[model samples]
Target: MNRRHLLTITAAALAAPRLCFAQDAWPSRPVTLLVPFAAGGSNDVVARFMAPVLEQKFGQSFIIDNRPGGGGSLGMGMVVRARPDAQTLLVSSASNHVFHPLVSGDVGYDVREVLVGVSMLTDVPTVLAANPGIGVNTVPELIAKIRATRGGFAFGSSGAGTSNHLAGELFRMRMDLDMTHVPYRGGGPALTDLVAGTIPIAFMNLPTVAPAAEDGRLKIIGVCTGERVSVRPNLPTVMEQGVPDFAVRSWTGLFAPRGTPQAIVDRLGTAVREALAAPPLVARLTALAAEPIVMTPAQTDAFVRQEYERWGPVVRSANISANG
Candidate 1:
């Protein structure tokens, strides 16, 4: 070969590895963290809280994009279609994975098929509480009160097809109660109505109503988890209150579009695991009544599959639709 051609070939060979390295070095640009809910909601709160920690770890900006619509399907759909480059992620709760698909007509993507779970951030227990004026101190008492009122009872939920709403539906079916389901725009409004006695009872996230329940403005009849949360060990579980097979847990996690590079997934997952363990982050989540979770990517995937299997039948049997 001519000297000029040989020199050019040598330069090209040397630059190839640098280009490959740049391509493989994930997060070459700012990461877009999608929260599939309105701002100021639980999902948004968790995403905004974790963004700074993750940005610090990766040395890249983690911009939170709130895409709220269709009961969290809009933003989640965006993640599903995003390139599997680890730059786009969905920070959402169990509702998006388990309930939204089950109820919404077409969520545009199947989480099981399109997304890979990285790790769960927290599990927020659902609480069944009533206005103090309702005078029910336990699940059984609440059941009895409902019976005495002859189907006059009404319960509020954050919105239709939400974790809180399904929890209330499960309670109603398990106990065979005849009560009206009142859907509110959000949990805060529902809780306000409950505290004002406008709504007799509500199945809500513990964080939203814990203050009122603690101060005796709202009477917490039972926790809707299989086991009582550590933060409220004194409270009895609904299962223990004579209701069989009643459990509902609200959780948030990080997920990337399916087929993301394993190396990227591993690196991001480790950062998340580290962030969850940070003392300041842990303390902040604790103050919000959120329990941090630890799980490998495989484990996170399995957990979501199990939840889908468990809750799918409940939603199907109830014939729950997003419209109602």
Candidate 2:
């Protein structure tokens, strides 16, 4: 071969391995899981539990960064603008991925278009809980009590446009009850108020309010799932209790910015699925009233899209917004 051609071939051969290494070295540094809600919420709980497992699997530290504001849109926006290197991922849920975009018109970008789903982590059932002082133990009684009171009553939730808030709105619409939604900064505060009797009723995540219900501080009037959840199979569903066609579950998942390498995404999804399948993680999630849902990356994406479509009409019909 000519010297010039030999030199060019030598250079090309040396450069190929470097490119392969760069592509394979993903998560070469610590990964950041950005949770849009406060630390104590369900999304945070899922992220925190999965971080250690991911760290071990990837051989790098997985850090959770809680950025709470704008009803989770704030943290979502941060992820939308981040590099699609899998170094930073958004720990997303129904609140931001499905409901917020439908309610908040100025989100700047479509969530499904900007974020790619990695895996679905868990599905948490929403519960209709009432303070013990409400003198109601079932959905029928709660509806009767609300009807008897001439003035409308308020029901609290984690925040405006959250899954629980949407569940409350759906119940109000379905039952034709006069109820105003009270949005707290987070589920922890709303739950605290429910236990303290500051709010008579709340539609909250089962995990958040299960402890109080067990202690007799509050009563779970009904589970909001269409069918009973495995964690609390004895609890009746709102639909079974007389509210027709009602189901709302707050789910958590992992999402990378659009354009993230498919390899990195697949690796992450595999790790998450394995973690969810393990006995220890399953036990922990079950105790928290959260069910581990193992979905492939494609399935996760399809599920998010389905949720967005499912809740769009609900938001529009109820006129839900972030400001309220």
Candidate 3:
């Protein structure tokens, strides 16, 4: 071969190794798992639990940063605008990723377009609960009481566009009940009000309200999952209580920017699955009433898309908006 051709070939061969090295050296620094909601929420708790495991697996720190505002749009926008180097990832849930976008006008970035799912961490079933004063022990009783009250009944939820809120809307739509929604800042406030009988009933995360139910402060009418959950197998599902196709779960997942490398995404997904399978992590998640749902990157993407499609009609039919 000609001298120029030989030199060109040699240079190409030399550069290929460097390119692979750079690609393999992902996370090169401490990674940030940005949670769009306030701390102590399900998303934050899951992130904190997985951070150490990810750190050990990657040999890099995985720090969780909470930026709560605009119903999670603020932090979501930040992550959407971040570089797709796997250094800054998003730890989000169905509330922000699916429900909020469906009900809000402009969330700055479309989740489907700007973010890609890496892994689905866990699924927490929602519970339809009532204050003791409501004197309703089951879904049928609650339905009867709602029908009896000519003034109509009101139900509480974590926030206007949250998953629990949508679940309430779904319940209202399915049962053809004349119910109004009472949105609180978060589940904690909503639970406090439910326990105080400020609201007759509320749909909340099972984990958040399990304590109250156990203490007799509140009555869990039924879980919103399609089937009974392992955490509370004795508690029947809304569907079993005569509400057909009534299943709503609050799920947390890991996501990266759209342009993030597939290899890194797959690596992260595998790491998450492994961490979730660990006995200690499984026990902790079970204790919190959260079921670990480990999914591959492709499965996670499909699940998010399915959720987005499933909740869109509910939001539109219920006429739910970000304002209320």
Candidate 4:
């Protein structure tokens, strides 16, 4: 080869690694973190609260898209379709994965197909309550009533397939009883109806339901966790009473399209993990009675898949459906 050609070829080889490194760095631009819930809700609030820190660390804006309907299925649908370029992330939690497919079969995306990006957040524990007049004072009492009534009691939840709905369903499964579930657009309406006795009982987020339990609108029977939440130390856990190894946790996390590079997922996960460990964020989450959950992308993925499989039988045995 001519000297000029050889020199040009040598230069090209040297520059390729730098170019590849830049391309694989992931997150070349601002990332959109989709929150499949209303603005100012727990998930959205947490997303916005941490967006600034992520932007500072990643050198890109972390925008939020609030798509509230079908619980969290709609926003997750959008995330599943987006390119796996680390530019998009879904702020998913337990509700989105556990209840959507169980209640309705046509969510249009196999959760397995969409790769888990990061677990941006999670709640401390789930909560189940009765609006009173159910004549149940504790978890066992409620279970006995359901057993006697043959699961005929009415219950309200955020939506057909939400973490809230799954929490209630799983609780029923453990007790071996059945109940009618009333799905609402969101927790706000569900809580209103529960207090009005339109629905006798329900499973809801702790943050949303704790106030009612305090104000006497709804009676706090038990927390759907293995241990009592420190924020409400007076509350007892369902497991502490009778059932063993029964814990239903509702959490919010982030997801991305499949095949998104590990580097990007790791980057986002690392940022979130670090942000969660921050004292200021920790204090804020504690005050809100929301625990900051940080997990590796793999850990988050496994947790979601387990919930999906675990809730399948409970949904089937209950015969709960979208139409119901």
Q: What TM-scores do the predictions have?
A: 0.83, 0.91, 0.84, 0.77
lDDT of 4 at 94: 68
TM-score of 2: 0.91
lDDT (10s digit) by residue, model 3, range 47-122: 8899999999989999999887666677878889999888899998888788888888567767888999899998
Of models 1 and 2, which has the larger lDDT?
Answer: 2
Query: Which residues of candidate 1, in runs, are more than 4 Å off?
Result: 1-30, 196-198, 215-217
Off by over 4 Å in 2: 1-16
For candidate 3, what is the lDDT? 0.86
TM-score, cand. 4? 0.77
Itemize residue pairs with steric clashes in candidate 4. Answer: 92-253, 93-251, 93-252, 95-163, 99-161, 151-178
lDDT of 4 at 103: 75
lDDT values for all models: 0.83, 0.88, 0.86, 0.76
TM-score for candidate 1, please give it.
Answer: 0.83
Candidates' RMSD to native: 3.8, 2.4, 3.1, 4.3
Q: Report the C-alpha lDDT of model 4 over 186-219, residue by residue, as the tens digit.
A: 6667778888888888887776666677788898
Ranking the candidates on TM-score from highest down gives 2, 3, 1, 4
How high is the lDDT of residue 197 in model 4? 85
Best of the candidates, lDDT: 2
* Model 3: worst 10 consecutive residues (lDDT sum): 36-45
Candidates sorted by lDDT, descending order? 2, 3, 1, 4
Tens-place lDDT per residue, model 2, 174-276, is 9899998898766777888999999999998898888788889999999999899988999999999999989988888999999987888988899999999
